[model samples]
Target: MKHHYWEAPIVIYLFLGGLGGGIFFLASVFDLIVAPGAGPLFFAPVFFALAALALGCFFLVFELGQPPVFWRVFTTKTAIIKWGAVLLTVAMICGFVWWASYLPLLGWQWAAGLAGLLAPVRSLMIGLAGVAGFGIMVYTGVMLSTLKAHAFWATPALPVLFTVSALSTACAAIALSLGGAVDAAGLGLLVEELIREIVHEVDIVLVIAEIVVLLVMVLSFYGAGNVTAQKVAARWVRGRTAPLFWGGMVGGGLLLPLALYLAGAGTAASEVVAPILVLCGGLLLRYLCVYSDERAPIPGEERYYERLKSSDTRFMTAWKQGENKY
Candidate 1:
């Protein structure tokens, strides 16, 4: 493998992309089934989820090599792509505004009173924005998977995998933030109860699925027998990227979370410790994936092949001329 650096912009792009897409998807799912009369209590998750998605998008735009070029995606005559981009932009803005007005007061004395008044309206907008954001999140995965050069991320499963990981990470973030708030308010028992009831079940399932998908992905690379793919897999298993693949991504993100959930299910001690440990592990995975030096090809590999048309033409002409003399 060649020595390639994973620059800061690329790292930010990976992290923000996953974080934003995941939060948006989770919020959408919740709004669809849980919103109608779940009360203002539900909004705690909704508001924070949207805020995280918004912050992720902010980082994405900030990391762009040419920030001004981003505007061109909207102005261009490309209808399908333009519409998707426009929808994401609109949803992000609306969701951010809503979250800003709601999340800060989750622990306030008058939170229930304030949310009681605004719940219906907030639920409606949150649902609409969440749906649109889900599409955008999936689109981010498609954008990466389309790149043929980086075989590691070229599989159709990349989008689905990204979606799952994103959702899991967002859930971890919510748990952590809520835990911190609960601790500050001296309500540690309530926090522990919440973890047992909510975080344990949902995150356990998510982590298990993530681990399975990761294994399948790695195995597929080994079976394919492509040199480039094999090289990428080697990097993941033993080279510079090993820490991310093993320690941060697997150990911290999936294994640790799964162990905590198992411990909590079997004993009382884990009830207090599992969620906190899982939250830290998830954040560490996010940071590693963002900062790791792994380069997957962009969506324009075909364009690179197209750009070498002259070389192909010369080779074809020489072969034809040589054969004609015989």
Candidate 2:
């Protein structure tokens, strides 16, 4: 039996953290455009992005078994994990500072004053958050791929692949919110009329990027000859995990959503459904990444089997020759 130290909570952390980070990064770019009403428009995704990040952090702590242990990553030289911890903290702080002005209940006087004072530097704050957000999103995949022992995840393309997925999921998240997918009763809070426009603005491009990146990642693995790599790649092919991989992540997550967008059928219903599919696909993709690697045989196990077969082949050949002589 293999030991999978990082399990579901960690998976959740990767999924949500990457997602939130992508949202922050995208929103930061939008916030800087400086259109007359663009501040309010971009700020809508800020709260959701912050919430996603906070929840991702919560799951990360949950996986650590103690909240205090998470802080240790910042103090240690754990590479990507350290980067992730610091980046998440910075992004969260900036997101909070930038968005707190809109919240009416949290000591509005000081918060409002702070927001007013920071208004001049709002773009700067958001810019920092965007940088951190990009790091946080890419770090999740980089950390996994850094596990050199896991031949499945040890890839040059995993980081880029995961980044594209994160961006796609982030767009889905924002589209979902705008489509009233979360709370139809709170429709007034959303600009439903902007749903198709948002999809056209961001998601269409992201969808194309995601498809291209996904193809590159899979083809890279598929073209590899390593037994462990082959096993991981097969998880999405004919293996037992293929159904979920192909059906959940590829079909529902990428293809279906892509089809909807290309057909110009991105109605309010699709605005809700497409994003949900993408989010589900993103979550399921995490599961596939985790389990596929975990399920892969340990390195050298295949060599051991091959050597055993070689010995068997030699013994059978000798036995046949002996019988022929007799």
Local distance difference test scores for all models: 0.58, 0.74
Q: How many residue pairs clash in each candidate?
A: 0, 0
Top lDDT: which candidate number? 2
Candidate 2 all-Cα RMSD: 9.9
Over the stretch 88-196, how does candidate 1's per-residue lDDT look in tens digits? 6767765654454454454665655655555556656667676766666566556656655555656786677666666666666545443333233335454344543
Candidate 1 has an lDDT of: 0.58
> Candidate 1: worst 10 consecutive residues by lDDT?
34-43
The runs of at least 3 residues in candidate 1 whose Cα sits more than 4 Å from the true structure, single-residue gaps closed, are: 1-6, 42-47, 77-87, 100-120, 178-196, 265-326
Candidate 2 on 164-184: residue-level lDDT in tens? 788888888876654222222
The TM-score of candidate 1 is 0.68
Model 2 residue 284 distance off true place after TM-score fit, in angstroms:
1.3
